[model samples]
Target: MAKTKEAAMRTKNLRGIVRLSALAGLAVGGLALAQEAPDRGIVHVGGDLYRAHNNAHNTVFLVTSEGIIVSDPINRDFAEWLQGELASMYDVPVRVVAYSHHHWDHASGGEVFADTAEVIGHETMPGALALPSGDTPLSDAAAALDANGNGQIEQSEASGNLAGQFALIDADGNGMLTGAEIARGPVSDVYPPSTVYSDTRTVTLGGKSVELIHVAAAHSPDMTVLRFPDEDAAFFVDIISLKRLPFMDFPGLEDVDSLIGTIQAVEAIDFSIGVGGHGDIGTKQDVADHRGYIEALRDAVAAGIADGQSLEELQASITMDEYSDWGSFNWLPNNIAGMYRILGGGN
Candidate 1:
């Protein structure tokens, strides 16, 4: 019986991996095309669901007979193109604009859908929107990034220093940026959701049902998991980066315990496949492993703290060598330092 149970577990894991591979083909392809412009790529994920792979992030949309529901407009131009696609392909007006979180890169162009769509997000989203803007003035950052000193920010010039800032620098209507536009600087538009929910909000648009489950103060105060029960697909951002290391600053987590619990909770839900805000597709096993990664890091840091190690000592001692081949090894130290602070009760 024990052998049979072990075999069954292996089979379950294999089945999950196979399903993940099938649903994640485009998701992997989407990563290779990350260099392409935001409007350049659109991935159709069976039925009425589709994902647009933008420069830095992805915007997912579902088309039902009643109307359309989209998550994250990315930016103005990306949203305009997404809106245009819906018009051209399905000819259905947008009924809802759902935000996964309140980060500028993901939710900025929500105003584009304001005419027809009812924007919805977590209750904490408004507070994030109300925070001070991080946009740097064009003149202030231009001299540093404008290589030619031509009073404009060219793609070549911006390439070196402004990798993460391109989504904000495109002031002109054209998708590409120019030195002149760079001179204008970064921009931020906050479109707060008209509808806010505390825990979960289930909306049946057209014929499909999606659950926006709030995992607050994890990646952000308003991070939401967009779950499609019928499709068995869930979209989560920041906490799980698939095979890659998280983006930056300990994956920008506010609470480590909350993040771990959230991942475990998501794993318990009925989902065949999952996708992050910024990487390849994921499986239940992937989410479990990510949780393990965090737990292991926490334990390692906790042990170090118990040993009375210094922050720098902990950083050197607690190397997550198992995940050394992951995307962002440089940020491992940052993760350790942050975890040390959390486990050590340091301010």
Candidate 2:
């Protein structure tokens, strides 16, 4: 009886282990399916132009006549989705991709479109990418978790694989980066652009004129805004987004007032519509809203300085609740800090 009882217990334990294994397998399969699902939030803007909000940090623009032009491709998954969407709209291939700045959220995904499309950026963009200050935490974690363990992080990782995606910078010089390192780098993937412009450049595709305008540093030193004059549509990449806070961690914060002025300069130009790097395409009001947010933050920081408040105090006191609903809130705190630094306080 004792032997029979012991055998029965062992059999029951084996069954339990098998059941657990099956459950684990099912869970993993479900996750894989979720990852492989089709892209959501792809929308049409009028006449051959499509805008896709891949998530919070990337926005892609597709022009059927002239192929596709992306403001900032955040990751490989997003890049793939963008390409697929363009293909669905136009039989022709994507011709060009323009980087808003050298930041990873705007540039890392270039590998996806880089192979086929002409990846373009400002004259200083290549140098910025080579520097080690534009990495992000979410990117680092994803890189660590990739199947092959390469340092390249993808969008899927930023969305689900990781708990939160935070902008990070790399202070250390090691080629292998930590999440912190990625957040600190100025730009990643510094490939030579097919075309580099100092002030402005124009490319005509399918009889449509696409103008790449270099707006003086508001978010980053090499910020570029793309305009489709005939379409009356403009893409203000990184300068603004829908619900998230704009990132102001670049070197241009010293001239916050000038940055706002530069944005106003763009506003003076007549354009019926504008698209941000991370949000929906809308009227010039979108541009004005972004400017307002920046101007408000600058004023708040300046007020804090007048009050003799420390950097930490200023950061805590300034609130972006009015603009919180705008995309990129994850990056707002950093923007505040950047402003504080520009105002002569360091933390």
Estimate every model's Cα lDDT from 0 to 1: 0.70, 0.63
User: How many clashing residue pairs appear in each of the predictions shown?
Assistant: 3, 29
User: How far does residue 110 in candidate 1 sit from its true spot (Å)?
Assistant: 0.5
Instruction: Supply the global lDDT for candidate 2.
Output: 0.63
Give a tens-digit lDDT track for model 2, residues 291-344.
888888888888888888887787677777887666657677688788888777
Candidate 1's clash total is: 3
- Deviating ranges (above 4 Å) for candidate 1: 1-40, 131-188, 251-254, 345-347
Best by lDDT, which number? 1
TM-score for candidate 1: 0.68
